[model samples]
Target: MSQSPAPARRRRGNARGEQTRSVLLAAAVRAFADRGFHGTSTRDIALAADMSPAVMYAHYATKEDLLFELSLDGHRSVQVLLDAEVGRHASNTDRLRAAASCFGQWHAEFHTQARVVQYELNALTAEHLAEVTVLRRAIQGLFGDLIRAGVDEGVFQVADAEMTAMSLTSLGIDVARWYRPTGAWTPEQIGHHHGRLALRAVGVAD
Candidate 1:
C-alpha cells in the first residue's frame, strides 16, 4: 500500500476547534522537547501558542493530557508507516530496508515531536503510558518479525532476533536526538544511509 501523510490529531469536534487543538499540540511538543515535561508549565505552552492558560485548558485538561495526545500520535504515526512499508514488500531484506529508512527519516523530519514522544514516557500518567506502550510493542513486533524472517531465509545471522530488532529501532530513534536541518544530509539521505546500515546490521552486505 502507498503511504498516507500522518493525520493530524483530532478532538473536540469542528474544523476550527480541531485547528486550535493542533496548534496547541504543536506548541506543547516544542515546550516539552525544550524544557523536559516536568520543567515546563501549561502556561508556557499556552504562551507559546499565543493563548491564555484558560483557553489552552479548554483544549487539554492538563499538560500531561497534551503529552499523551502527542505521544499517542507520534507512536501511531510510526506504527502506521511501518505497517504499510512492511506490507508493501515481500522479501525480508526489502521490508527491513523500508522500515529502517522510513523510521530514521521520520525522526529527522519530526524531531521535536519525536523527541517528546521518545523521551516523555515518564511524564505520562500510568494509564496513558499503558496505551502508548501497546503501540510501542506493536512497532517493535514488526521489526522482530522482519528480523526473524531474514534469519529464516538464511539472509540474517543475528543470534537474538529480539535484541537485534531493538538495536535497529534504537538506531532510528536516536536520529531525533541529534539531527539538525543544517547538517549535510537530508532526511531522505540519512534514511537511506540507515537503510544500508540496517542491512549490514542484519548480516547482509549492502
Candidate 2:
C-alpha cells in the first residue's frame, strides 16, 4: 500500500524551512562577498537576512555549511549552462559563443554569489575545498573541450587549449568583480560584447 503523504502542516513547515534556507544563503553570500568569510559571523548573516541567529542556525548547521552550499550552487549553475549549450549547438564556433555568453550573463546577474564562490573558496575546510575543487575542475573541463572542438574544427586558431580556456573563463568571471547593473550595458549586451571578444581572442573571425 502507498504510504500517506506528509500532513499539510508538515508540508508548510518544510516550505518555510526552504524559504529560510534560501534567505540565509543569499545573506551569507552578501556577507561573505563584502566582509570575507573569516570576517563574517553567523550573527552577521542572521541580521542581514532579518532573522535571528537562532533561526539561521535552525537552517544551517554551521557557517561552513553555508559556504559549501554557495560554492556548490555556483558550480552547478555553470555546469548546467555548459551542458545545455554544448548539447544544443552543432557548430564549434556557435558552441563557443553560447558557452561564453551564458557564462558572462551568469556572472553579471549573480555577481555576489559568483564573487563569493571565486574569492572566498579558500575559507572552507580541506575536505570541503577538495569537493569544491572537483566541481570547479569539471566546469573547466567542459570549456576545455569546447576550445579543443574549436581548434579541431578549424573555426578557431589557438596556441594552447588549456591556456585559452583559462583566459576565456577569467574574462567572463572578472565581470562579476566590476560589472554594474546600472551601467550603460545590460547583462545581455555585456554578454554579447564579451562573446565577440572571446571569439576574437581565440582567432575566430567575427
Candidate 3:
C-alpha cells in the first residue's frame, strides 16, 4: 500500500533532518564562541555553515533556540563523560582524580565549544537557562559524590566535601576561558595538573 512507504520515507527524512541539525549546531557553537551569542545572528550561522538562512530557520525558530541546543548538548556531553569515567574506577581517589582530569581535558579539547556553552548561557531564555542548570547540577553532583566517598573511605580529608568539589570543578571550568592550544601546557598536561590539584583540594596527600 502507499501508506506503508510513508513510514519509511518519514524515517529517511528524519535522518536527513537530524544531519542538517547537527551541522547547524556545530556552526552555531563556533559563531557564538567567536562573536558571543549577543553578536551572532541567524544569517551569520547560515553563512558559517554554508547553508541558507532559511535552512537554519527550518531547523530552529530563532538564534536563541540554536544557542540553547548547543548549551544543552554540551552540558549533556560533560555529564556523559563523567558518568563513563566514574563507572570505570573502583577507589574513590582514582575516580575523583579521573573525573577532574576528564573534565579538564574535555574543556581544553573543546575550548571553543566550551567557551560558548559555559559563557553564553546568559543569553539563553530564563526557561532555557533553568533547563540547562539541571545538567550543570548533575555535573557538580558527580564531583561532590566522589569527594564524599573519598572522605568516607578515609582516602581524603576535606572539611566540606561540597565546597571542595566546587573548587576542584572550577579548575577545569576556568580553563575554557583561558586555554589556548599554543599555550605552555597541552590539554593532557593541564588535565594531569588539575586532577592532582583536585585530589589535593580534597586533602589527598602524596
Candidate 4:
C-alpha cells in the first residue's frame, strides 16, 4: 500500500504557492549554507527571495519550519538517488559502489543544500528531527543491506556491516563540507573515486 505524505509535505496548495515555496527553499539553501541555519533568520531568507516577511510567513511558518522542509526534502533525495543507483546492479559490491558514487556526486552537485541537511540537524525541532531520521535511516539501511549481502557471500570482510555502512555514508556527506566547483576534482570524478574507495573499504581486492 502507498503511504501518505507527512505534514511537511502538505504546504504548497497551488501552482503559485508551489512556485513561491520553491523560491523560498532555494534562497534558504544558499543562506543556510553560507551563514548556517542558526546564523540565518527568516528575514535573511525573505530578503534573499525578494519577498516580505508576510509573504514568506505565508509560505513557511518560521525559520525552523523552512529548515525542516529543506531537511525533509534533502533526506528523502539521498534515499531516492542511492536506491536508484544501487538498483541498477545485481552484485552486492556493485550496488554499494553505485550507491557510494551517486551519493558523492549528489553531495558535490548539491553541496549547499546538502551542507545544511548534514551539518544543521541541531537547529531542527525535536519533532522535525524525528521526521527526518526516518528517511536518513532508510538511506543508511540501503547501503548497510548491500554490505551485509556481500559479507554473506564472502565478498566483503567488514566486521560490522552497519558500522561500515555508516563510514561509507559519511564519506559522501563530508564531501559537501569542503568541495568547491572550481576545485581540481569534478563531482563525477569525486563520485567515481568514492565508489572505488567504498569497494576497497569492504575488502574488494584488485
Best model number under TM-score: 1
User: lDDT per residue, candidate 4, 1-206, as tens digits?
Assistant: 01111224756388898889888988998999889888898999999999998999987789998889888888777776676678789988888888889888888888888899899999989998998888888888888988999999999998999999999999899999999999999989999999999999999962
TM-score of candidate 2 versus the correct structure, residues matched by position: 0.89
Best-first order by lDDT = 1, 4, 3, 2
Q: Score every model by TM-score.
A: 0.94, 0.89, 0.91, 0.94
Better of 1 and 4 by TM-score: 1
lDDT of 1 by residue, 43-77 (tens): 99999999999999888999999998888888988
User: Judged by lDDT relative to the true structure, which candidate is superior, 1 or 2?
Assistant: 1
Output the lDDT of residue 112, model 2.
81
As for lDDT, the candidate ahead, 2 or 4, is 4
lDDT of 3 by residue, 1-206 (tens): 00000010111357789778878888988888888888888999999989999998888899998877778777887887788877898888889988998899888888888888888888999999999999888899989999888888888898898988788777789899999999999888988888898887877764
TM-score of candidate 4 versus the correct structure, residues matched by position: 0.94
Evaluate model 3: give its TM-score.
0.91
- Count clashing residue pairs per candidate: 0, 0, 0, 0
The CA lDDT at 133 in model 1 is 91
Question: For model 3, what is the C-alpha lDDT against the true structure?
Answer: 0.82
User: What are the Cα lDDT values of the candidates?
Assistant: 0.88, 0.81, 0.82, 0.86
Best-matching candidate per lDDT? 1
- Runs with alpha carbons beyond 4 Å of true place in candidate 4: 1-12
* Residue pairs with backbone atoms closer than 3 Å in model 2 (clashes): none
Top-down TM-score ranking: 1, 4, 3, 2
Task: Write the number of the candidate with greater lDDT, choosing between 3 and 4.
Answer: 4
